[model samples]
Target: MSTKTGADAEMDAGGTETMTVREAIRSALREEMEDDEDVFVMGEDVGEFGGVFEVTAGLMDDFGEERIRDTPISEAGFVGAGVGAAATGSRPVVEVMFSDFLGVASEQIINQMAKMRYMFGGKTEMPVTVRTTEGGGMGAASQHSGTIHTWFAHFPGLKAVAPGTPAAAKGLLKSAIRSDDPVFFFEDKMIYEQEGEVPVGEDFTVPIGSAHVEREGEDVTVVATQRLVGESLSTAEALDGEVSVEVIDARSLYPLDTETIVESLEKTGRLVVADESPISYGVHAEIAARAVEEAFFSLDAPIERVGVPDTHVPFSPTLEEEVLPGEEDIQAAIRRIY
Candidate 1:
């Protein structure tokens, strides 16, 4: 495990004050738009309403309506327009109100934007960022609260990034905006207001495909993504004397930092994956399969996965609590493997 020190370390305004995750993202977009002439923000309710969740709040006033254009409630049409604009030389950050709405514009994303560069043999660059809120925790119900990052991660041509911290959120958002490829930026709906220290000024980018070790130990490795990172950290603290568990955040899903995971497994000799998605054919399944195939010789026991049961996200709070992976589930998995 490597620690990002010196310049890589997040410093605040005057090298003292810190910013939140949402604020960091806001700063990134603000700075990028200010510095670049072609950069603009567009989507439904992005302008006057400042977005459904206000992620793009205040940008409309700052950048003006021409840059922060608002469109109708047509996901397919606006998404397609963003793709076309990106291909034609504009840097457009398109917001999908909910990740579940991606299904409505799958053709524009998977078929058009993702395949554009390769189809044109690298002659064109689709520099489009599809920003959307994902994951569950609030009472958003099934249709609004699914962890659909895996759907985009499954695509080869699109870059998938999920930031767990305010700093990661800021850095990764800048990197996604600058990239010449289509990026699916997944922001956990619950973490929107979760405060953390973030850099205040200048340009910084957290390179995609890199994983962060949130907490280090020698007994077992808990590989988590998005909100699961918080759960894993809590589980690690609770099981402090009982077992040693290392928590890793795979911030970027498609460009998964599997090498880091395999290396950690080599030291710990055990592994567990905690995800919000269902256990079957999900991100946890992919991680489990990769660890077994690549690090089987180092394992002391079978790899385990803690995730929602194989079913749609429940609307009832009781059923939802029962289905979601929690600290108890993570502790049980750790104890079983240990």
Candidate 2:
């Protein structure tokens, strides 16, 4: 595991505790539940089943059925319940088994959960965190494998974060739980097994709305989110002496760290935004737009975007592989500009 750096080192002096993304998320839940009695987790198969992805594995044994609630197979009902609970002064971490199912509960999330505080003139507290797994690497097919995080990121009065690493998974979740605003935490199902060094301290939290620079470079800047962050980093490494590629992990979706991205673009003068969402009106467009508006003068070449074309995730492994964005796609985007 890599050593601690930046804000991670400051919050965690104990140092060097490595874990998978799943473990980091579970640990964050355990710590948050223990720290605050009001905090609890509720979702389908989250109790005895330990979650479909097993991210909530063993949480039931520790927190019991009350805290680690198992809801009926109804996303809309449970999500609405979570909103009600949050409004009544409870910090509920609701998990929608798969992010694709989030559409079933879109009304509750986009309406009640998102608009409550504003509708109530900021008097009501909506400290709720919705955790859902996203991405298509598992071959979960069109319905289950869709990456629709951009919807919430664009929605008003909602905070969204998509973590790219284990530390980020843990730290960002902790911050999301504590946040007074409703935060949607998107976890890429493919990265659950990926391991990295995460902070051991309970107080550790990567601030929401912040981005982390995974690698520094000069030739080009590649801004990525979730799974693409690691893929872009690998692409950067492969180019080594050939291309100095700067990789930035955009952990927060809504509060896109344009400052960090613009700074990198000012130096590199070229950009490639890589995300799993569709290219049209997706995360890549938002990031690229921000760069153009903020750092248009620094551009040496047109910004490139790497993402899936406007299409559903194919059920066939071959077709899925063909459409999904990856290291090859990232490398190709970089090559076009260079």
Candidate 3:
């Protein structure tokens, strides 16, 4: 619904369309599969069930069971198979139903998939894209709902991205699939249904390691990820005349894009990092550390970090809501330094 802005303008041109995050992701999978016979999707419920989040909806019908494979309820097995497939010259797009379960396959992901190419002296190719849903707000509880992208982002030899909009979801997914490196594509589950404009071509892709400035302002700069990107943008829009808050969608977490944040800080001199990850030793902490190292002299006040407290997501909706940072949290964080 964001109209006339860069996000909207990108779609207004020919070969662009509007869709939901989930749809965009599915579309990206379709395009990649069509473009490459080596590209295939494997995950639980990905084939017949069309994915737990329906991100792979209709993919099986289009690509058949061979291309859209459904594995057992074993995360370690399927994820390991994906790593093997990618190493053997096939581009495997694996989906772990919930990112929280990624811990089950950490050995294969961290030790094998992430380390293969580097460990093999550049002999191996890891064009594997692991698509996993993250974030809380659906009350999926600690077992199902969790923001664990920081684990991959912090780990070396692996690239990580968390897109906040439909266009980003589509473009980034395609980029991850085409990448010759292992890319962890973390999609915020809460935003899957969120609508936005996306490019309509198979060749289009949002470059990895770049940040998208959703809104520009000369005041405080808010570097946000996942759900917080849209929330912070809405908060900024609501405070149009009262306070000018610049919002940046941190699409790529690993390649933190410190240049964009530093440039914005050079102008605004104030920063608040909004992440769905925990407040400690996570995405927000890394970004804040980069800001301090790069733009410490430009900072006008203490950098604020808005995120979930260091605790498991509670099963109770009220308790979950209490811990998850929201628009109010972003607004409050922005106001603290002003």
In order, candidate lDDTs are 0.85, 0.91, 0.89
Better of 1 and 2 by TM-score: 2
- Pairs of residues clashing in candidate 2: none
Kindly list the per-residue Cα lDDT of model 2 for residues 1-338, writing each as its tens digit: 12344345754565758899999999999999999999999999999999998988898888898999999999999999999999998999999988899999989988899999999999998999999988997777999999999999998889999999998899999999999999999999999988988867787888888888889999999999889999999999999999999998989998777888988988999999999999999898999899989999999999999999999999999999999999999999999999
Give me the candidate number with maximum TM-score.
Answer: 2
Q: Using TM-score as the measure, what is the rank order of every candidate, best first?
A: 2, 3, 1
TM-score of 1: 0.94
- Cα-lDDT of candidate 1: 0.85
Error of 1 at 46 (Å): 1.5
The runs of at least 3 residues in candidate 2 whose Cα sits more than 4 Å from the true structure, single-residue gaps closed, are 1-6, 11-14
Error of 2 at 47 (Å): 0.3
Candidate 1 positional error at 245, Å: 1.6
lDDT of 3 by residue, 1-77 (tens): 12243334456575678799999999989999999999999999999899888889898889899999999999999
Looking at model 1, residue 231 earns an lDDT score of 84
